[model samples]
Target: MDTIKKYLESMFEHLPKTLEVMRAKDELYSMMEDKYNELISEGKKENEAIGIVISEFGNLDELAEGLGLSKVLDDLVSSDRRYVSRQEADDYVDAVVSRRFMLSLGILLCILSPAGPILLDSIATATGLNLFTGIGVAFLFLCAAVGVGFIVFSNYITKSWSFLNKQPCYIDDETIDYLKSEKEECQTGNGMLLAVGIMLCIVSVIPVIVLDAALNVPIISDGVGPSMMFTLAAVGVFLIVFSSGRNKAYKKLLSLNKKVFAREILQQFADAPDNGPEKSVKIERVTGEVVESDYKDASYSSYDKPEQSSDSTEKKVKNFIKVMVKDYWKSVLCIYIIWSFFTFSWGSSWVIWPLAAILRKPIEQYFLGGKH
Candidate 1:
């Protein structure tokens, strides 16, 4: 009997609580309950009785089809599912604004890390004056350290908002309207930023190629060109990242929108009714008695989210690094080896790793969501 009620609840879970729908649900429950009792009286086991009743009633979709509520059910499914409120949406967008800037700054620093050492080395080679040995090495390591700090800090600050990535929820029309405007502004309003960013990236290495070929001084051309190239590319990427803040927020919202309601790993699991205050679960506690019920008359509700308590911000950063490497390890390795060989500055080549991490999501999303 409990099994039958639970199954019935799940079937109507996403449906609207209209009079017609409620009437249909009550009638179906009555018939199923009668059938189950009849089967039990005939000596059918409890499990066998449940199986028979469920099979006889069939699924909700099949039943709703005759009443022309199939389309209604399909559309209303998301209405009852988890939804994001306006406040939550605003908080997310604001967080992304800061996060994107920090993330871009971190990547920029990483790109500029090798630039310092390369430029210094080039100047030293071109000049007759000798500087302290290992000065360039110290500067290289310093920039790398600062870059790592920014990246890690960005990851830390955004850790609380990571739920927008993995958890699925719906949003009301109002929130949708709000997000649409923000997203459009990000994509269309900042057209110049996007274009300039791409232009900078495309022409970033042009200085190296042009200067290396045109300049008679090999030390100046080869050394200084790479340092300048990284600076230009880093600034370009920073603009791209910063400009896409709202765009990222909107995408995150859509990804979390459970459009087609179905079983998901993080879907709600408690045996809660979709209607009727009287149908709420209640638990009566008896002293020295075992509490066996999964739910009581009144139960608290929340989506199944990852355990965030006691989790350090670095956890996500490390996980992203792993994912970044897993998806783009070969490409990063090839770039590192080739660039190191080309410039003969292995220390400066370390910049590529952070750059790969910063750009992984966009590149992956582009290919994954690209039109075939």
Candidate 2:
């Protein structure tokens, strides 16, 4: 009974140490189990099989070294309280400010160029503005003013907006411990930048719309409204493209592609303090297993085999497609309703509004619910 407890404890001691090198303990456990089953199939008894499993756990000192545990431990012990780093605060500020400005700019642009143009053309043709030189001149002048407003506002907003210097983040002991143990490093790359941009774009839309309507010249209302909406659409599309590029860049940056990193981590572990009971236990286990054979017999291998993962990834893909399809459907219905209303006034146009009213509810919810 004592031996079993000792063996079990012995087997798990490396887990805590390995936690410092791993992304997730569960992934390590799964990897270990797979290795253990491979060994058992080679005719080793259960205890020997377990021993073999413990023996091949790679270099702990190297892993700890890679994770920078020595620095982490020293920092934790030395700290009187959790203090936020200047860099982290700076990151937060940058993120917030970028987001706010992108939003504000997007809104301003949308409003200044509102989607009233297409409807204006429709109204102009129906009302005979083309034949009337006076009315056509007025319409042209209104468009020119809206175009100038969009350019000036967009430039001003983009230039004036800047990220702040201080931002909020976790500075707790547990957070530091987890980050240190996992050896997971974060790089605030283009994705965060892009995220801030997207959020700002979405939020700015409402404000842009309100401002455009409030500033409308009575006769130029229809033309200005559509112009603003179209301008906003263009900005949103541009931001989406920029955000996508940033994400791609970030992914490429995190692809640690060097073998030297493994050895470096091992060295870091070897230098870490050996004072704590947990640290000592992990060191002993790694030291013991540094020379184990790496073979796994066929019979034991089956026990550690990965289960057939449910098609969850497929389900997620389908769900995304479903959402997109629903959104496309709603947008189509909305456009149809609007076009019908503008073309056919009152009796026939009135029916279009009721139909739009029915379709608009679900479509509005879809867009509003999904917006960042």
Candidate 3:
């Protein structure tokens, strides 16, 4: 019975949320329930009953046309569909954890970056060599290369976890429910992270002020104060990165589930011609490959009006822009804040806009693809 319900839900998941569709779904559910009960009463086994019920009513194209959702089906079939399996979900989680660890390591390296110059200077001075010469500069570059190597290696490892790139990865109901719950938890975690991060940033300056006034020791006054602040800032950044990574992972799972459900329904009715002969198609089951029928001469243009098309286009463009901004807004904000702090000019911070525009696509593709 649960499997029957889940199958029906998947079939209707891609349909539009219209009142008519909703009513039709309810009717279909009731019909299936009745049929299942009848089959059981007639001495059929539970599995056999479920199979019969689903096979009888699982043609989504027929359901869609009956429920006045032919247009919705058409649009859904045209869009790309994605799928994820239980193994892929586990792999995705591992990849996210690995990436987060790498990010933390990168952050640690950055915080210790000043040590590179200081270490080289100390070594040169101890060896009676000039500390401000070519050797020191070369060592500094070597330190930089090491940091870059860590970043490059992290990226390579992340790309090697290519389960996400494979389409129609199989998944079960338990995985879907787990991912949905995880997504909710991630949202709550993000909120808590923001609150804690802001609190840390604010409290960071307080220690410097209090310690400087209370203690007169040079180490405490000069060194410890700034170091404490840097530590707090680093912690705040860590929280934000952790929260963002988890949130992105959960979102990716949820998005994949939705796409996969839609694709499954599309495939179920792939050869049906209720939408017209042009929309009749075949999908390769093993590869989950879709071969769409050419609809060049299809008279289904009545489903899409010029005004509706324009509005949809505009909405899609807006959504793309919004996603792009959401993905990189933190980096952009950080750049602006850093520039403003150094130059003390908010106007000059505007330079980040053009830089963001130029780098946003590539950065998203390489750095944020997992999240998307």
Write down the TM-score of every candidate: 0.53, 0.25, 0.49
lDDT for 357 in candidate 2 is 25
Q: Candidate 1: lDDT over CA atoms?
A: 0.64
Q: Give the TM-score of candidate 2.
A: 0.25
lDDT of 3 by residue, 69-176 (tens): 787678667745434556778678778867765664544343333333444454555566775335545644564456445545565666755655466433445677
Q: RMSD to native for every prediction?
A: 17.8, 20.9, 11.5
Deviation from native of the Cα of residue 165 in model 2, angstroms? 37
Sorted by TM-score, highest first, which candidate order results?
1, 3, 2
lDDT (C-alpha, whole model) for all candidates: 0.64, 0.41, 0.59
TM-score for candidate 1, please give it.
0.53
Best candidate per lDDT, number? 1
Q: Model 2, 1-372: lDDT tens per residue?
A: 233334434433322234453443344456567777787688778887766655655443433444455554454345332234334434433444454345334333322322344445645655767544444445544643553343344333323222111211123333334334322333344456445545544553454457557875533444444444445444543344334332322222222111112223334454675343454345334432221111112112344467755577976776665565444423333453455447732112212222332354465455443211
TM-score winner between candidates 1 and 2: 1
Q: Give candidate 3 regions above 4 Å deviation.
A: 7-31, 40-80, 85-90, 115-147, 152-180, 205-216, 252-372
State how far residue 283 of model 1 sits from its true place (Å): 35
Q: Give residue 325's error in model 3 in angstroms.
A: 9.3
True-vs-predicted CA distance for residue 140, candidate 1, Å: 1.2
Clashes of each: 4, 27, 1
